[model samples]
Target: MDFLPPLPLLIAFCGASVLLAVTPGPAVFYIITRSLAQGRRAGLASVAGVALGNLGNALGAALGLAALFAISSIAFTVVKYAGAAYLIYLGIKALRRPAEVRDAALGTADTRRIFRDGFLVALLNPKTAIFFAAFLPQFMSAHGSVVGQSLLLGATFVAIAALTDTIYATAAGTIAPRLRGNKRAGAAGRYVTASAFIGLGLFTALSGSSRAK
Candidate 1:
């Protein structure tokens, strides 16, 4: 009975979640690329997968597993390095790929494959887990059931993420054609994607642990 967050806190949580979701990140870029290359359905599926991954992080935070991960330096380091390596690998792969091959791969990619790819990309991201652990606890009341509050917060986060991600996917889809038609623009898109992945990799590698006592 005492598990629910206050209305104002809930509103603030929702607003913050929406804003974060809209902010460009590796996940957003992946979704945009998938949607633009494949179709709207593929994009939505990718978003759903990402939502599930985020939910997993939230659940881990709610259950205190994230705290365990945060405290264990070995585990944290493993996850962090893995994420960084993957991002770098993706960036390198993007850069090496010819435009025609990239277009072919994009065009032929299946929705389910895209969904799985997005899910894995999110699941291995230590930053996402850390963010959920740090961000959700601030809005939680000590008097409330922590688990329940965590779940509510996580759900709110996912709802906002889903809505905003969909908007990005749709907008990207709408504009993809114009870029695709222009050879120079298409080349620029590839460069941007490669740079984003590399930047994210470096950022993740250099970021300090988000654990707060």
Candidate 2:
């Protein structure tokens, strides 16, 4: 497509996306938690939901939602704190749901709900919108349609994320069955996941606005 970046830029983008995708972050934590709790299928579903939500952010960024963040500190702060609160809320839910969790593949994973939550988790994060705004432009060329370029690059990012996220999910799923069978281990596992979520929230809260000014 004419919207696509040049070969050298594509390679650079791919490499950077891959590196970021592999890095354990909030999205990765959510996917991994789902995998260990529900199995690979749920984890993959979560990935799909997250990807869709990210696509939305990419769209929003293209439409100038990100511009608002740059211009208004209040707007950015409100969304940032809100996202952090949501993460902490989800973490609390996981912590409280230990009784529902079982050894089975699904356990209490609730793939459908997980999907929705994953979508919201990604969608609500102003930081993600900001990240894409900052991250995608590095490879863009002035010659292409700016909006088309943004969407193309955003889709590319989602594709890379889906691949790497699935890898994390599958690997976690393999160990899930064994861990879930053991009552103590399963409980412990959920707590760990819960802790990761809460930690991410706290980190996001404290770290604030990673947007490249």
Local distance difference test, each candidate: 0.74, 0.81
List the lowest-lDDT window of 10 residues for candidate 1: 204-213
CA error at residue 104 for candidate 1, angstroms: 3.2
The predictions' CA RMSDs to the true structure, in order, are 3.3, 2.5
**lDDT of model 2, residue 126:** 82
Q: Tell me the tens digit of each residue's lDDT in model 2 across 1-213.
A: 668888899899999998888888878888888788778778888888888888888898987899998899898888778878988997898787736444554655577787898888788778888888999999998788789989989889888988999899899888777775687887777788789789877877778666311
Cα lDDT of candidate 2 equals 0.81
lDDT of 1 at 195: 79
How far does residue 155 in candidate 2 sit from its true spot (Å)? 0.6
TM-score of 1: 0.82
